[model samples]
Target: MSGYVRPGNSQPALLFPFIAGVVVVLSVLPLVRLAMTGLSALAAGGAISVLADRALWAAAYYTLVTALWGTLISVAIGAFFAFVLTLTDIPGKGPLGFLFVLPMMIPPQVTALAWVQMSGPSSPLLKALGMAPPLGSPQPLYSAGGIALLYGVQHAPLVYLALRAGLMSVPRDGVEAALLSGASPFRTFRDIVLPLALPGMIAGAAIAFVSCIGNFGIPAILGIPASIYTLSTLIFTKFSAFTDRTFGEVALLSGIIALISVVGLAVQERALGRRDYRIAGQAGARATFSIGGWKFIFLPLLAVLLFFMLVAPFLALLAGSLVPAYGVPLTFQTLSFHAFEEVLLRQTITRTAFANSLFLATVTALGLLALSVLAGYVLSRRRDAAASLVASLIEIPYALPGIVVAVAFILVFAAPLPVFNVTLYGTIWIILIAYFASFFAVSLKPVVSAYRQLDPALEEAARLAGAGFFTRLKDILVPLIAPAAGASVILVFLIACNELTVSALLWSTGTQTLGVVIYNLDDSGSSDVASALSVLVVMMVVIMMLLLEGMAKHLPAGVVPWRS
Candidate 1:
């Protein structure tokens, strides 16, 4: 009697809540399983404590080091690019901007493969230029420095996107006032611009650090060879390596990592509390400054950064895919499309992986959109203790990395439970659960933000007119927030498509995705096939983005702004 009742609809409104409840249960099953596993392990003579020994400590140290370095380098390069693109009249700015940000679209494994091929002693550039010592062997590809370089290059574009938005949000009037007051450019940036943009920088840096720490493929491909390890790498090892099938240990380490991420999130929230530096105002014309004397210095520096970060790796992927083998000299005669053909035709692996990736991504996107919209509505409209608690609990996954979530899923789903006889160990169901847990925050954030912007009076008016909750949601909120929801779905699909960490660990042989295929090929020393798969995955992502862009033009204006 207290629930929603639709007037015009044939079906009862009770069905909606029932469906929603079922979806929530299905979505949260993996997390429940993980908790059970961890608890079970904890009871078994300190299984959790034994796993967090010296090896894990070392991994934590290295993870912190690389994440810090990567975040620092990413911030520097991203700030420079953001400044150049927004404030300077650089030549080919549009094309350069696209090129700079494109790396972020490609999966990290592809970038790692490209660097591995290029840094080889027999690389065309090194060999032709005689840069490699004749007696020296090929340089190792998996050193800590190499991992840092890949991390920096891979995440630079993420920083760029964040800072670019922040740069555009700076009030032109403030800058004009500073300049008119005889403040030099450097002084103005130091005094006014940076302080205003500090939140964006911190947000970008925190994202980069979290992402870098949670990354599995880059370190797996580049760091594993050198015996360098991170928490993500260790998680993968415990899950996959035949020698290390200690589920209890894996669960403990994963829980610890999740706890660390949670702590970081709390700290960030506390640090940003009551800080009102967020940009707010009507739109104005973008301000540009002349880079008269420093164009020479600034342009070349940006070019070099872009080259190493974007161009070099992609080109390496292309070249490696064409060449028959890794560390081999490239020539017109030696180049062939054999790798591509093999990946597409001869090997069923790539095709199957692509199909699986597409399926999982689609389902995850749809599921995330539906759940997020409902949750956002409840949180925004109700504002009660229960709703607030649920909202906060929903965010737990965001702090935890994909690798940890995957491990947690494995820990929970592999054990015997009361209701389900067969565990969800090797099913596509586990992958879907992991995807939701890892990316649900992304879908929820935009919807929640958009919901907050809406005036409560509109909804109150609708309710006063006898508009039921479902009717108001369907006729009012849905249309207004369609764009936000659409954008959220697309972005979630993108992340799920390129997701390697969680998928790599949770996927069974039958559930292989493009990310898994590429990683497997790379691990098996089939660099050419891996490169080809990487290129194909990138193309698929581009196609998906194009489709989303087309769909976006039809959406409301406010929704489009939140796409990035």
Candidate 2:
């Protein structure tokens, strides 16, 4: 499993120690503290209080039910796109894939807000179209089904990404051989492709379930109003209403969330672990099946999907932004930019949020880029259980929900530090540290994948010529992996800039982020301003994605995730 490392070319002496230190600080320490806190709470009879509460059981049940349903929806939508885009002659695959993945990148609360504005009684867009329901009518999205639907929408891209990776690895030779044996396209797909792709499907489902269970934004926005509480939102509510037991109780709650996520991951492992689904082939999978005239049907189907998933809600958000008030209709005469003015100019909090978010994102991206490069190099070269364990540790913080990570960090940093006695509990520094811990996995993956593809002979040769480790990396490795590194930086920046759940809990007055600002605007009855802000954020996301799309040509395949 090692990369092209030549023997006798040892890694830098301090590399392993540095990586381990980072893992311990970012991943292991906070989680260990969380577990300890929860165990302590249980030992102190907090378990009796927590376990005996009907609310806790209800929240857990709701979380599992919604996550399961969301996983099913995600798999269905994601599988359809994965199969079509990877295996068939679909037109505009690149653009379609990119658009389909956009919903996932857009914050879940934003998606929920946009959808809420697109329907129901108070929908400005719907009201303008003379299609809104009566004022007292309940919001269609403020229910359990609504939460599940939005969860699916927000997470389907994950499934698409996971399944598409496996689908891309399907053997072209196997497909061709099956065709030569007179197996029809349908038979070949069902008999060979289906079985081979099952692992990917299962893995995607597992990931979707974890994501859904840990999702705070969707459930917090949709479920809470309807009296449907998921574990994530329940944790938020508990924190919102602070108490003496808040820390310990939240620790227990976070443990539950972590336990559920771990089980899902474990199931994924068990499913993929038992099988050696390796195949022999010269060429990777390609679009072997041409749908021909059926593209007519499929094209419209895809267009409709995109319309609902991206176009309609965005239009509603735009319309809501233009309206003078929440329920006001948008027209040439009534269109207003007051909301934009309020968010971009008048609101000091919003301005502070923008600055804080940009600062955090830039720092986090650059910081992780540096660490990921070092870690990636070491990980790619070292084929040992220790390296694997380190990689998994890096993944733990990321795999758990952002809220859970935030809680863990809070527990770890709530007190003043040892020598400095400086506190990070209510500062931007804590948020930055959490971002490093949470998004390290994102920054490292592409770099590691790029590193694996590199030829090790150059580095070895350079080392033999008396070049030091940094010198060899600068001369040989850096230039070759520049594109992937650039992609990693931008990807982390995009994610960090819009992150809410982590910052939501971590932010004090001055450290508000874009995500928190938007959520706050809407919650404070300034839907128009929120919509306006969401519009800008959505624009930012689109621009970032387009930048990545432009870089897709130069970057390694799969490094730009939305690209095929």
Candidate 3:
């Protein structure tokens, strides 16, 4: 056993800290430059204003209102679904559960484009039902309400996943005792289930709120047509449409939004600290409640919701992608693979964007995997205040909206500051850095969670037996936690591959990514090409998810303690 102890205390453990220090420096270097340049401009009496304009304020207000409303609706619907699935004997529960999870696999922009096609008056189903209207008419597909609907539908699955996990883990004995004590089903759920699942529910809601607040694609595609704007769109307009140069005022607004998101997340974490519900032993004897007449009603209701939310949007996108024209009736004559051919051959930009997105995603995922593993190891083993602080700060980027980070990067890198005199604008490295920061929190979560399950005594035993840190990490921790790390890496890559908002704002002529290219085509009235690109993105993500699933199957038994 002593022979298993790792040697070289300082050097091996130093690797992660060294790498983390370098990454942190790289991340902050641009911000430092921005502060210096902004200050210098102010001192010279030629500084651009840092306060947001009235348009920006209006946009921010719209964004906040929609996000709040969307979050509330999502939480309520998600909780309802969770309760139904967990407590009631609803028919097709298994299939319904699977269907509810399908939304997460589809990208938001794809869903928006699909809804646009479906809401069109010339759509086949609408025509078949004799409900087709004139060429131009008011539609829910082109308003803030439509954007909120899209967001809620897209994010409800996330909340369901969280709440379902929480609910399934709840002790049945508690609920059973409540029922035996003359509690009604509703009372038992309110007092026993709701309180127990609140932490996960809150976590899910927070995630949804933050995601909805920062999302740009749905609002841009669906909201812009109805003359609605959000903070993300306003930032895009300020940076791209209003002027070629970045505005300090827009940056300030972005910063403020980002700050609010950060504060909200911090407050949430503090309020919920160490309150997580965990089951220490086997959950013996599950209890089920009969829904009586309500089951028949709910089963169809769920089916209709799934049809409208999941099936309709995807089918519409498929129809639109195949149709030659948007408003034209969907007939066999109009349907063709012409859009796909154009996307493949005529659109070099689309192909180039795909390649760039793949490259950046691959790099960012690998970088995040390596960085998070090391950081998690340090945090888990060291248990120092500094490490704890670093752990907390890692979450800041998750709360900060992508558009905000993009604007901040522009402010910092468009000018020279301190040791970094080169402008990184229009470079792929800038995009990679931004993505890395945006997704670091995602990568960190699973790894940290996995690390927490590991016993530090195992490492200490190896160290005492003369094995080095790298050897111990390699032969022990790596093999043990590899599955969690891989899952985190793949998830991060998938997100990066599908990310649009920040990429739309920051992508330049030479650095056009898939998301940017698709948006540009959509903005320039090339909906077919954009639809084709969206299909390709969705396909890529699907492939990655399948691969991840396969890889997960091969992971060692003890790799994912949470799963066990």
Candidate 4:
């Protein structure tokens, strides 16, 4: 409200156009291109052939079923945790929440890989424990339920975060009033807490469902061998078997995915419609329930859950990495670091993947931050229709699935540029560009939030002292928002490093990312080496998260997600 731009302002004239141009290129153009292509395909009657295919229908069915089941599972688990952790006197809530969200941060393929190694007849850990299933028994994970289970595990954090946010606003006075009136805990929760949290739960479920639909790693690992295919995997396969009609066909498929995602969002909106969830009194979350004697039961229950969710599978991955071969039992005599040595020293592909992912993440994080600082100034300074439109445009790419964005880029850049005369397809630069587009919103949010919280008078005084825009930005703006900028960089880096969906489609021979390399290794029957690389990737993710966690106190409140 305060950082208004006067008429004939040179800064707005320069900044607004540049920011709009970047958004058009990064978000608008690609999505429009995709939409046009899909419509053209449909107009040409290509949809009949594409949509009538039994395989396509099967994949659609699988996509919906798995996503639905997965959403329910995610909601159940996420809601339970959110309610207990937010409303009760749970000890070690910080650490428990951190551990619970770790699976979401880790790559999906790594999660599948770890779970695969934790069970089945081929499991090295289980084999070592002499509890291996009979040889030739089909692994259970290669099924619809297995995929949904893993989907639940992977996306549960989304629900937890969403619902926790809503629960945090539950008025303490209402709960206290209900309790004083002799309402039992169950009745009070059902009447007061449930209504307020419903919207968040629905929103979380919608997000989880969309995520499951877009997921490539889990189904690709667990479903492909069993001939099960989700829409994402189906699209990947259609691309794999490329033909003259491949572009049109894939466009149709991507449109289906986009349509489904939009529908999920719409359902969430409808469910939350006509409901005023506003609280009148003081609104800060605090423990409303004292589980005095229930602590003993709850503590072990949570510990066991965390053990299965984080500890056990990670240990299995460790065991798998140390084993000399995939199926070999991990014993004191048999244990070796051969997989680690091979992955780190012998494999050029692994090294390239590590380098490429790190480089891409670092560049994307820093690059987006620079742009975000400029864009954030424009956004926070103006409260006009254009600013709101630009903000929505920025969110489109981030909200849509990564694979859809990747497809859009492929369509846009597969041909050589008009002036530059260079093709970005099949190169690292394409991946980099895609990363920028996909993560621009992520890098901008913190900067914008920080900017909104700033005192405009500080900048006004500096401007009145004849300080130029960039000078004010560098000297005042950047310093004040440094903590948030740091948080943005770390968040984007953490996501980009473990990214599989976008890179899986955009990667070339020499530009394999960590996610791609890990998937390929597992696909190519080098499970041990894949496990080794996954272990390293997981360690990197944890280290980055810890760095953010350590800096949480200095950063803005919501900047460090998974923190209460």
Strongest candidate by lDDT: 4
Tens digits of per-residue lDDT for model 2, 321-402: 9999888878888899999998889989889999999999999999999999999999998889999999999998999988
Tens digit per residue, CA lDDT, model 3, 1-564: 333322544235456467567556545554554445545545644334543256666787788888877787788878778878876788877567756766766667777877776776756446534567776667767877788888888788778877776766677677777789999998887877778778878887887888788888889888887778888887777676555335545655565576667666676697679675665433733346878999878988888888888777666667667767666556766677888998888777877887888899899999988888887787776666777677666665666677877776777666655586767778887788888878888887777777888887788798679777678878988887887888887888888887887787678877898777777787787776777777777677667766665665655332322122
TM per prediction: 0.86, 0.96, 0.87, 0.98
The residue ranges of model 2 lying beyond 4 angstroms of the native Cα positions read: 1-10, 274-278
lDDT of 1 at 431: 90
| lDDT, candidate 4, 446-492, per-residue tens | 89989999999898888789787888988999999999999999999
lDDT of 2 at 247: 93
Candidate 1 residue 372 C-alpha distance from true site, Å = 3.2
Better of 1 and 3 by lDDT: 1
The local lDDT score (0 to 100) that residue 152 gets in candidate 3 is 86
Per-residue CA lDDT of candidate 1, range 473-530, in tens? 8988888888778888887898798888888888887899888889899899888888
Clashes of 2: 0
- How many collisions per candidate? 2, 0, 11, 0
lDDT by candidate, in order shown = 0.74, 0.90, 0.73, 0.91
- Which rank order by lDDT, best down to worst? 4, 2, 1, 3
Arranged by TM-score, best first = 4, 2, 3, 1
